[model samples]
Target: MRTINRTDFLSGLVVAALGAAGLVEALRMPRFEARGADPFTVPGLTPGLLSAVLCVLGIVLLLRGMSGRNLTEGAQPSITQWTRASAIRTLFTIVMVLVYGTLLFGRMPFFYATALFVFVFTVGAELIDTERRLPAWKLLIGGCLLAGGAAYAIDFVFTDLFLVRLPG
Candidate 1:
């Protein structure tokens, strides 16, 4: 029988590790006064929920990686996992994140920085993932919409619903 694919296994491990770590950290957060506070206004509420979701998703990924179907080329054949293109993409991602953290963070208004980050990341990811090319105009518009929607949702969740203030 074929073994699990290395990429799948590694991906699962990384995700699971991050999720577990996040869950631990989230659990350690102190509970706020709930006497007059909304139940959702607890400091750990969002983090705990997100961490749990991540853990579940990571476990699912791990199980999928262990399954013998669609993970590898075949039982006998060897397959290449990483290519130059993939390496370039990974490097690009690292650079993008670095720029976001060092340049956009604390330098611009939070929403504007988030908007740029989301738009660039989403557009790049979509372009890289799809083989069939989409029109640039469509991608640009879609990225803007996605970024705006995400920023609005996050702001509402943190500032309004959770009553947490965000840093610029």
Candidate 2:
């Protein structure tokens, strides 16, 4: 039986690792202060801020786990009892995210890449859901709209509002 503390500890470690990695990558983004660009307008600014927050939250969780603060909550599902379906879903999401980050983001125009990723991820997730009630047609239509809308919004906000030049 795994206690909540143990689960939190493991989750926190993973979150912290991801956050730290993101922060490192964000830091590597070009800073145009040399060209008189505002520090807040740097491409890395938002990502760095978000990553730092994630890392701090993860550290807090790790500390709580280390202190066994949730021991009183008792045992939860054991590793052996973890559902195969759940594991597959988790792994699928992770792989999709990794592919989007490493392959898609910088390889294409931001709007197209983001739309593609969002569409594929939404459709794939819906298809994989055993209890999903939405039909394939609905999923397709919804995914398309969602992808387009989200991509447009993100692009508008970053490019127009934030003045961030998204990579092609």
Candidate 3:
């Protein structure tokens, strides 16, 4: 078993705390009983369920980390070691998500924007990954296909099945 370092302990604590906070917030959402809203359809239901799952997973992680068993084998990187490639990938993901959430999402048609974002994000991630074997043309084609399919599926689910109107 790998040694449960301070990083694992801290990560577990943070994740559990966040999950707890989310659950609390979800619980505080309006039930809408006066409007006869179905319990399953309540705004908080999904979040509450997801938060509970997170809380359970976090607790498991926390317990595992607290076990303090040391690995008898391979070397582990220190938590303080932030490689340049890792940092770049992290920053790129953050920037892409921020742009998608704050800029592209509501500014254009849902399908087009989502497709664009998915394509760019997939292509960018593949390009950034040092171990990626796909050539540029294949990457672009795969990205496009993935993006289009994902966007279409999401759009169809939300717009048709869930009956949720997406902002154009």
Candidate 4:
């Protein structure tokens, strides 16, 4: 009786796949060991947990789609919109992520790489959307603050709490 949105159903499936892949990769990471490592302090702590969360959320989305529930309007973009999104914004984001993870993270100091990645990605994302038309200065400052704060938090969590030395 109810019409299930094909877009949500498909997107849900895609997200679920990505989550599953992340979970598998996380599982392959080194486990907690005897070198002052607690059960919760494994190298895979964050990634593993994050992947599990993603897997759960993706499953929820899949269920929502299958049940013919009204998924968020924004969740299902029009074909033209989707094309534009994928072509520009989404691709840029993917490239940024790859660059940060592969080229920056371990190569440079942790703080520098983290800050650069966050700031550039945030500012680029904001600026790309011509609709919002946010000022450059605001984007820069906000991006800087957000990147700095987030970088600091990540560093503190890894170094102080997890005792993981993110490559400096």
Instruction: Give all TM-scores, in the order shown.
Output: 0.48, 0.56, 0.54, 0.51
Candidate 3 lDDT score relative to the true structure: 0.89
Write down the lDDT of every candidate, Cα atoms only: 0.79, 0.88, 0.89, 0.84
Query: For residue 77, what is the lDDT in candidate 2?
Result: 32
lDDT of 1 by residue, 1-168 (tens): 967855566667788888888888988877765466765677777888888888888878777778744733354333455677677688779988999899997798778888889999989877776463778899999899999999888977998899988767
Ranking by lDDT: 3, 2, 4, 1
Q: How displaced is residue 146 in candidate 4, in Å?
A: 0.9
Tens-digit lDDT string for candidate 4 (1-168): 987766667778888888888988988888657576787877677887888888888888787778887747675557535666457997998899999999998999999999999999999887787686778888888899999999999999999999997899
Off by over 4 Å in 2: 1-81
Q: Model 1 — which ten-residue stretch has the worst lDDT?
A: 71-80
Between candidates 1 and 2, which one is better according to lDDT?
Answer: 2
> On a 0 to 100 scale, what is the lDDT of residue 166 in model 4?
88
Which stretches of model 4 miss by more than 4 angstroms? 1-81
lDDT of 3 at 132: 96
After superposition, candidate 1 runs with Cα above 4 Å error: 1-81, 128-130
- Compute the lDDT of residue 127 as modeled in candidate 2: 87
C-alpha lDDT (0 to 100) for residue 13 of candidate 1: 77
What overall lDDT, based on C-alpha atoms, would model 2 receive against the true structure?
0.88
Ranking 1 against 2 by TM-score, winner: 2
